[model samples]
Target: MRRRRGLTEEERELWSRVAASAQAMHPARPEMPAALTPPPREPVVAPKSLAKAFRVGEKARPRTGHDLAPPIGEGLAALPVVMDRKAHRNMVRGKLEPEAKLDLHGMTLAQAHPELIHFVLTAQDRGHRLILVITGKGKPGRDDDPVPQRMGVLRHQVPHWLRLPPLGAVVMQVTEAHLKHGGAGAYYIYLRRLR
Candidate 1:
């Protein structure tokens, strides 16, 4: 069995003095005061300059030029009246015949524009009343973006372009052909015969 050596009398007295000093130096901390609670926060208010800066009102004036016109007369002169889809349907539905068709299914906006203009002129020259243009419904190609060559590009743009000065005189009316002819992707162009 192992025996631990005992401290000398002087050493024991020194430890007792240290223990008393420690107890006196560090008395227990008192409970926190209730008055030390955080003060209530005040509501925020924006400065007058900032409030005035953010205020909005009606526009100064109405916009003018090509962009202001309806979709049918977008880049064209102001006609007496603009035809809506229903009115256009009535104008071209039974008037167009199958034999006068001009298929432009895969033609790009660039190719189609000039080709369409020329076709209208030629048709007018030949005294053809109804000419069908088949612009196929646009498909989302390689990048998932629409193929402008198909439906979206021409379907919306063609009517606007047809109403322009050069072709307006020759083109009596333009409307989406019936589903049997080609649906929304095709247009039945009715021409005013050359005088």
Candidate 2:
């Protein structure tokens, strides 16, 4: 696959303006496609070398908890994945500073998904264990309409992306960050160690 490129400053500015104007116009929402019956699951290919190198244990499995968001659309959110107590404590206390960061401020889901996959893979390869991903809390539409508003789209989508297929292998945990780290607009990604 051709490498996905980050949006330039100019493109970002243009997109922001376009999105704003489009929302202002209050265009009719598109009709939803019919949902098909669920297909058989395909087995995910895990990188054995990396898993061995990371020495991941049973603790790496995603556990059930209150932190999970309910299933939405085609994406299913992982069950409130979390790190060990020490790591979680450090993160909450702002002691475990992120080793890397990714800002997904102006990108749509189409644009952000591939970029997200690439970023996580690269971070894992580089031995980064902690990453902060900023997905801007999306703008809320005018409330006069009877339809429910779509707000903070990525806030719901990012977690789903982290739990799907190949990308899920490298991501050990996903948590909402403190206000200093962007609050509801971002996530802390804990990656499996690299060899």
Candidate 3:
């Protein structure tokens, strides 16, 4: 390595003058007012947010503030586990085959809600312990609307409906399906046994 030398007084003076006379390549821009400026984003995920341990049929803790609604998998995990532990594990792993299934993909909210109630109620009446409800991961694509539309209405709403009046009384548990059973595109609805 070569020894470095400090700039002599004359050399420093020359550099200072040259720099002072030179123009900036880009003009300075005025700082944006705080009201108009976008706020700094929080970390998409933090190390601390991850679960310390992961197990089959484990509930998920929320991870980010940007989510309009938690993903179906996470939302289902947060719900209290009402089914048997062994059955729950087997079901989430796609081992326990659903006795029946309902597909709500391509239907609007108005059309889907009533159908879901009817399908779930009829399934319960038939003594089905578990049923699959396919909402199809919502349409994935570019959303250019200025009004801000949130897609996957059924994916988010179905879980709420399963836990609400009418159907809530019969629905025992709800969980995201495994890869063999349609992965994130479907749900496994566990219905309560008839008295």
Candidate 4:
């Protein structure tokens, strides 16, 4: 008979040992015990006042907390305007002569605020009708979202700031400048000449 090619004495002994050990080991099972279940998630609770503050479909009342009137000329009035980069260049290059101009580059919001107030007052004193304020195109920074306070901060805040005590008398209206100024980046401040 031909010799069979199979496990040698050492191999056969090792295989038997492994088989016996596996048989003695605990069998694998499908079910997990109840104690191993994950803990239940807690429900989120909102504040009572916030939950009841605004309901769906509720009509919002006009905010009366602060005065909404413009500083001068019976309140803010709409004016014809244009906002374009090319037009801004023409306006700045003196190719187009606006009534007046104020540049706010390299100025922080705090610095610009007081300066703007003073400039408007001076322009009004000088009897300048239309003044251009160049706040520059707002730059997006490292934050995930755009800066909450930007040139738009100036655009929106300037009107409100003007409505305050002293500056209000000089500023009749404030609107986005024509393309000749800086467009949305700039503003055309209309003033009432001091009597």
RMSD, every candidate, angstroms: 13.5, 37.6, 22.9, 17.8
- Write down the worst ten-residue block by lDDT for model 1: 64-73
- Which TM-score value belongs to model 3? 0.62
TM agreement with the true structure for every prediction: 0.49, 0.57, 0.62, 0.46
Candidate 4 lDDT over residue span 1-195, tens digit each: 999999899999999999887763677786878899888889999766744567765797753233234422133334332335465445434455557788888677889888987888778778886687787665543333433323234555665776686877776656555565566666666566567
Put down candidate 3 lDDT per residue, 21-84, tens digits, no spaces: 9999999999989899998888777457565677865787643223465566886788788899
Give the number of the best model, judged by lDDT.
Answer: 3
lDDT of 2 at 190: 87
Candidate 3 displacement at residue 40 in angstroms: 48
Report every candidate's CA lDDT. Answer: 0.65, 0.78, 0.85, 0.63
Off by over 4 Å in 1: 1-99, 141-151
TM-score ranking from best candidate downward: 3, 2, 1, 4
Give candidate 3 regions above 4 Å deviation. Answer: 1-66
Q: Write the per-residue lDDT of candidate 1 for residues 3-55, one digit (tens) a residue.
A: 99999999999999998877456777897688986788998997667444443
Misplaced by over 4 Å in model 2 are 1-82
lDDT of 2 by residue, 17-54 (tens): 99887744586777756675477799999866744445
Preferred candidate (lDDT higher): 1 or 3: 3
State which candidate has the highest TM-score: 3
Better of 1 and 3 by TM-score: 3
RMSD of 2: 37.6
